[model samples]
Target: MMLKAMTVAGFSLFALVATISLDASAQQDDNLIPNDLAIEAYQGGWRSGGSDPTKECLAHFNSKYPTKRIQIISTSEESRKDWKGHVEYKYQCTAAIKLK
Candidate 1:
């Protein structure tokens, strides 16, 4: 009976640890910008017409979220025909801010 109780307690501790870790990882993921929104920001920056599209996009993000650390995780370019010939730049980003 004592051995069974100890085993159950150990399992419970392990489960608790697992749950906490998963929760932490989920919280971290929540800080990341969704892919579509990141791409939208990049496109908006490009449409604004500047010397550097990437820099423009970063500036937009920084201006919008003054407190967070914004990082571009990935970027891609594709050529498209809309009003003529144009290239679209897409970005994937993560924004993290410290909690008080």
Candidate 2:
């Protein structure tokens, strides 16, 4: 009886570990975003155009991360006139997303 009980306890422990590992892996997969979309957004932000970065970023993200729908929550642009050389454009954006 003691031997049978030990075997059952061992099996239960193994099952518990397997379940926890699978859950962690699934959570990691859910957090992953398309690399191309993130890269494009970073690059577009550095470009010199006065164009809306949020639009460009979202467009790139949608095109590359076609599996998700992104909703823009807010957008803002700030410009500073410096006597130095060229006008500086700072763009900021916030968004929410639904993943499939």
Candidate 3:
């Protein structure tokens, strides 16, 4: 009877340890960046004659981080003429992650 009880206790301990290890690994995976999305802001500029500068900024961000989708949170535009008289556009964009 004593031998049987020891075997059962050993199995229970092993099961407990395995469960704890699996839980820890799952928690670590939850902390990984691939599972989470963080909002990031970027600035991009284009010559005046080009398409919308705000769109240009978003496009640039999408090109850089193709895996992540961008949602436009906000945008600000600045206009300044360069030496060549071409209007330079500066765009400030705040975006949230739409997908991971």
Best by TM-score: 3
Q: Give the TM-scores of the predictions, in the order they appear.
A: 0.33, 0.42, 0.51
Each prediction's whole-model lDDT (CA): 0.47, 0.58, 0.69
Q: Residues 1-100, candidate 3, lDDT per residue (tens digit)? A: 1222224645742222222236677787676446457677887745565667568767877897788777777888788887888787778887777563
Query: lDDT of model 3 at residue 91?
Result: 81
Give stretches of model 1 more than 4 Å off.
Answer: 1-53, 81-100
State, as a TM-score between 0 and 1, how close model 1 is to the true structure: 0.33
lDDT of 1 by residue, 40-64 (tens): 3344422422235456557767787
Better of 1 and 3 by TM-score: 3
Listed per candidate, the RMSD to the true structure in angstroms reads 11.6, 11.7, 14.4
Model 3 residue runs over 4 Å out of place are 1-35, 82-85
Error of 2 at 11 (Å): 67
TM-score of 3: 0.51
Clashing pairs in 3: none
* Candidate 2 per-residue C-alpha lDDT over 1-100 given as tens digits, one digit per residue, 9 for 90 to 100: 1222224645742222222336777777885555332312233343455578677658766786688777666667667656876676767666556654
| TM-score, ranked from best to worst | 3, 2, 1
Candidate 1 clash total? Answer: 0
Error of 1 at 22 (Å): 11
